[model samples]
Target: MPPFAYRRSAALLALAALLTACGGGSDDDDDVGPATPPGVRPVAGAEGRWDGRTSTGYDVLLTILDTGETWGLYHTGPIIHGAFHGTSGSSDGQLRGSAAMVDYDKGGQVHSSLYGGSYVPQRQLQAGFVFDVFNGSYVAAYERAVTTAALAGSYTGYAGGWPHPLTLTITPDGGLGLTPASTDCLVRGSIGPRPGGRAVYDMRASFTGPNCPLPHGASVAGIAVLDGPRLTITSVAPSLVDFFAFQGHR
Candidate 1:
C-alpha cells in the first residue's frame, strides 16, 4: 500500500482494536459484576521492533519495551536521523502512547515533535500521527520473533499476487531461498539478529522469468514472528502495495 493508505489502515485497525477491547455495554444491559479489573499485564504483541516508512519517504524505526516505554528513530533523507522517547499503556487489549523529540538548528534553536497512536495487536500493527506543527502519520506492522534455528523449515505461502504459491527455505545459518511458483523471481537473502529475540531479514530478487510485473530487482525487508507451527512476516519496505502478506504454516 502507499504510505498514506497504510497509515489510514493502521489507524483504523488500532481504533477497531481499542473499541473492541474498551467498548462498554449500554445502560439497559446488566452490570457485569463491576467490570474486569485492569492490571499491569504488560501488553501483548507490542514489545518489539517495528520498521516502516512515512508518507514522505522518511524511514521510521520504532522499538517498544516490555516496560511500557518506547524509543524511536526517524531518518529524513540519507544521513539525518532524529530520536524520540515516550511511554505507552495497554488497556483492554489496546496500546497507545505519545513520544517527543527535541531538535536543535544550526544556531541552536529548539524544535520538538509530539506523536501518539494506537497499537493493533492482532496484526502487530502500530499506527499513529505526529504533531510537529506539521501533520504527519505512519503505519507499521510488527512480528514477534525468535531465533533462526527455530524457524528452519519449508513454508508455502503466497506473495505478490493472490493464489500464487511461494515456497521458502530458511537455513539455520540465517540464509534463505525463495521460489514463487507463479513468477521467475530469484530471491535470496540473510536473516540477521534484532533485539528482543526477533530476526531482521532482507531479500533482493531479480525477475528473470516471463511476464514479471516488478522491476528487475526489488528489496524485501521485514521481521518475522514465529508461533508454534505458524510464521508471520511483516513488510516494512515493500508494504502491502508490493504484496498483501507473507503467511506460512509448517
Candidate 2:
C-alpha cells in the first residue's frame, strides 16, 4: 500500500535557514566547536506529531522530533512499530530516513521484521511510504493531524473586491474536503487533518476557472490560520508584489 495520490500545488516561500561550517583552525586547534551540517537545521516547517492513514486505511501515528528524527507506530495485519531516524535539509524538500519495523505477537514476542521507506514533502503536506523488507510490499500516506472537530463548518472571506466563501468538511474517517469560493476562480484540493491541534494547516490553492485573472492552473502553496471564529489564509507567489491573503469569519 502507498500514500494516497495527493496533488501538489506551487512553490512555497522557503522559510528556514541552513547552517554552514568553516575550517580556518590550525591542525591542532582544539577550539573548533562542533559544526552543524551545511543543510541540516534545528527544526523546520515539518516538525510535529502527525496522525496518518495508509492507502489501506490503517491508522498511523508519527512524531517527528525537532532533531528531524522520526518515530512511528502502525499495524498492517499485525501490531507493528518502528523508529525512523530521518534528516531534513534547509534547501531540500525531501526528508529521507531508514526505517525498521517489528511485528509483535499477541504475547508481545517479535513475530517478524521488516524495513525501508522514506518521507517526502509535497507543497504544504508531508507524506511517505514504509516497506516490508522481505516482500518489498508497503504501506504509506502520512499527513499531519489535529484534534478532532477543531476545524468544521464554513468561513467567508474577501480579496480584491471579490467575496470568497470557504467551506471545510471533515470526513467520517478524518479526511478533509475544502471548497472555497473566488470570483471566477475554481479552487481544487482538499484541506484537513490540521497539524496536531495547531492553528496552521497546509493548503494547495490552485486557482483555475473562467474570468480569473491569475494564470491558468497557477498554483500556490498556502497555510491557513484558525482563530476563534476567524480564519486567515495566505500564499506567496513571485509574480505578485505582495502575498495573497484572505481573512474569513466562521
Q: Which candidate's TM-score is highest?
A: 1
lDDT of each model, Cα atoms only? Answer: 0.44, 0.37
lDDT (C-alpha) at residue 143 in model 1: 30
Write one digit per residue (lDDT tens) for candidate 1, span 38-90.
44242364555555666556565555655666555444432223444566666
lDDT minimum window of 10 residues, candidate 1:
23-32
lDDT of 2 by residue, 146-216 (tens): 33355566655443223334454433343433454455666554454343333245554556777442355
Clashing pairs in 2: 145-196
Per-candidate TM-score against the hidden true structure: 0.43, 0.34
